[model samples]
Target: MEYVASLAFAKEKDQQDPLNKFREHFYFPQRNGKDAIYLCGNSLGLQPKNVKAAIEQELTDWQQCAVEGYWAAKNPWLYYQQYCSKPLGAILGASQQELTVMNTLTVNLHLMMLSFYRPNKQRFKVLMEAGAFPSDQYAVETQVKFHGFDPESAIIEVSPRPGEHLIRLEDILEIITKESDSLALVLFGGINYYTGQFFDIPAITAAAHKAGAYAGFDLAHVAGNIPVELHNWEVDFAVWCSYKYLNGGPGAVGGAFVHEKHASNRDFVRLGGWWGNEESARFKMEKGFVPKKEAEGWQQSTAQVFNMVSLKASLELFEAAGIGALRSKSEGVTNYLEFLLQQLNGINFQIITPKNCNERGAQLSLLFLDKGKEIHQRMTDAGIIVDWREPGVIRVSPAPLYNSYQDVFHFYEIIANIASNA
Candidate 1:
């Protein structure tokens, strides 16, 4: 698809977009009294128009039904996970029995590690990418320490070649083979936050299994941006936060996936809570912890219904739009963005994201050679809401659900103007 550098072309694309109606369902932020082009869904998504009503419904249940609301609410608070799992499972490519909404992203990461990262003296090392999200780095560091191993010795970081920004798949597979004797787990971010490279999950999972190690992923960047088959790939476990691409409000409830093979193992070692106990036995309040034979068995507390309401509301939109259709729109719009950016002159930057659409999602990470912070500020002030990371990378994500080709064109226009002045 050839991209034109004019606003008319962008508007024409938006007019023809089958997903255009979705843009109206969200409330964008205001800058200079107009809806800002919101390109920061990679950070925090814009609020869905229905979220307020969704929260109000819960509040009304609390007021009218009191504690009975757990059983009587429109969406039974007692079974909130089911409401979330149905739609979320579709986007994540898993069965409802294999997924659950629970604690935040890092907390779920810790729980998955505790259950899966059993290490013997011979095979105690954890293999991961060099620059994972900081939370993952910290969690893995502490988990290895808790098990009485030196992090430097127990953690194998697969780095990119010195001059390259992305890690090579061959290098990761080769390291898994070389360190197979001591490797206990292969954990990775589905898409690296900084570089926006979508790793090959199925290949990585197979390699880890062949090496006699468990494979897991933190899918915070991948979950709603792209469709993934966690079950088909036979990923042992995966975790994600909902606020980014899922369009749940800030700090929304997080989700987790445990393959049927692992979720069905009631004897799996994990921190037990009443919510995780078998429903029939839960009211008895007995001593023995008979866990459910599903992913909900990992729950450590009662459902945070208020926190989860936003995600449930957002999933309605996902159910309507479908993740496959969203990905198709994403590839086209993101490609248009790339094309427009390349047409810009005098900008001292390089797109660090993988060029292949299959190797990325809706994001493009621009690594600037100079005054990156200043340029980012200019973008924000001009009502273009992209995010900047340290070491000079600005993340521009046009979420297919709400953002438009016009949004992308406006972003390109701002950058081109900034380049001209610089």
Candidate 2:
């Protein structure tokens, strides 16, 4: 797909985009009264215009019905979470009973770990990618300590071979084969936050199961950015935050998936709470806990009605646009950005993201040979919003919902000019 180098080309592409009309649904930020070229959806997504109305409905119910609003609201706050399950399941390619919207990412990780991470004397080790998001690392470390094991001795960190930027499929398989005797779980991020490399989830999951280890994923960066089949992949469990590519506002509710195979396993240990109790008997205030038979059995508290409302608003948009269509546009947008960056050869800038679109989402990590932070600051001053990671990586994500081809073009133009001037 050849692209023309002109504003007219961008306008033409926008005109042809079936999803372009959806951009008007968001409140884009402006700098000095002009719309800023926002490209940092990987960090925090722009708020949807409908979010205000969604939140207002909840407030209205709270004011009108008081305590009765829990069962009397328009959507019925008692059952509000049900509104999220089908749509989210569709987005995740999972069955409705296999998923649920619940606590934040790290909190959900702890809850899932309470049930899945069953370590013993022989099988007491947890395996994970070396450069996973810091929150996941902390969660795993804390879980290991809770189980009376030293993290250094009980946790296995997998890294790419020396001098390599990405992990090879064979290396992961080899580790699983050699360490299966002591490994209890294999936890990994669906996509690496820094390098933007998407791991082969199916292959990894198969290897883990073959070696008698449970598999899970932290999809903070992958959810809504790429297509995932958690149920079909036979992954034992997974958790993800909705704030990133899901466009659910900042710190929104995260979700979890428990394979149906484990849904009826009463022997699996979990931290019990009223919310996870059998829904029919929850209000009875029974002395004993009878856990629900589905994924909702993992919840520890009542739903956050307000945060879930924002998530519902964003999910309605996703339902209309469809993940397949969104991913199609994402590939084209990110590939074009990569092409433009490569055009600036010998400018001391390089893209660390994988070359294959199948192996990455919308983010491209740029490593500047000199003055990375200065260039990032210049781009910010130029009305382009990109996120800077530590050391020397600037992450630019062109979200399919709100970003246009013009956004990518303008971003490249600013970076190219900065490199030349430097």
Clashing pairs in 1: none
Point out where model 1 deviates above 4 Å. Answer: none
Please write out the lDDT profile of model 2 over residues 1-422, one tens digit for every residue. 89766668877888898988888888888976888989999999889999999999999999999989988988788777778888988778788888888989999999999888989999999999988889999999999999999999999988988987788888888999999999999999999998889999999999999999999999888888998999999999999999998888888999999998886565567777788788899999979887778788887888789888988999999999999999999998898888778777446767888999998999999877687888889888888888998878889999998888888888777777877787
Give the per-residue lDDT of model 1 (tens digit) for 1-422.
77889999999999999999999999999999999989999999889999999999999999999989989988888899789989988899999999999989999999999999999899999999999999999999999999999998999999999889999999999999999999999999999999999999999999999999999999999989999999999999999999999987889899999999989999888879999899999989899998889999999899999889999999999999999999999999999999999998887899999999989999999999898999999988888888989889999999999999999998898889999998
Estimated TM-score for each candidate: 0.99, 0.98
Candidate 2 weakest ten by summed lDDT: 263-272
- Model 2: lDDT of residue 106: 96
- What clash pairs does model 2 have? none
Error in Å for residue 106 of model 2 = 0.4
What TM-score does structure 1 among the candidates reach? 0.99
- Model 1 residue 260 distance off true place after TM-score fit, in angstroms: 0.2
CA RMSD per model (angstroms): 0.7, 1.2
Positional deviation of 285 in candidate 1, in angstroms? 0.6
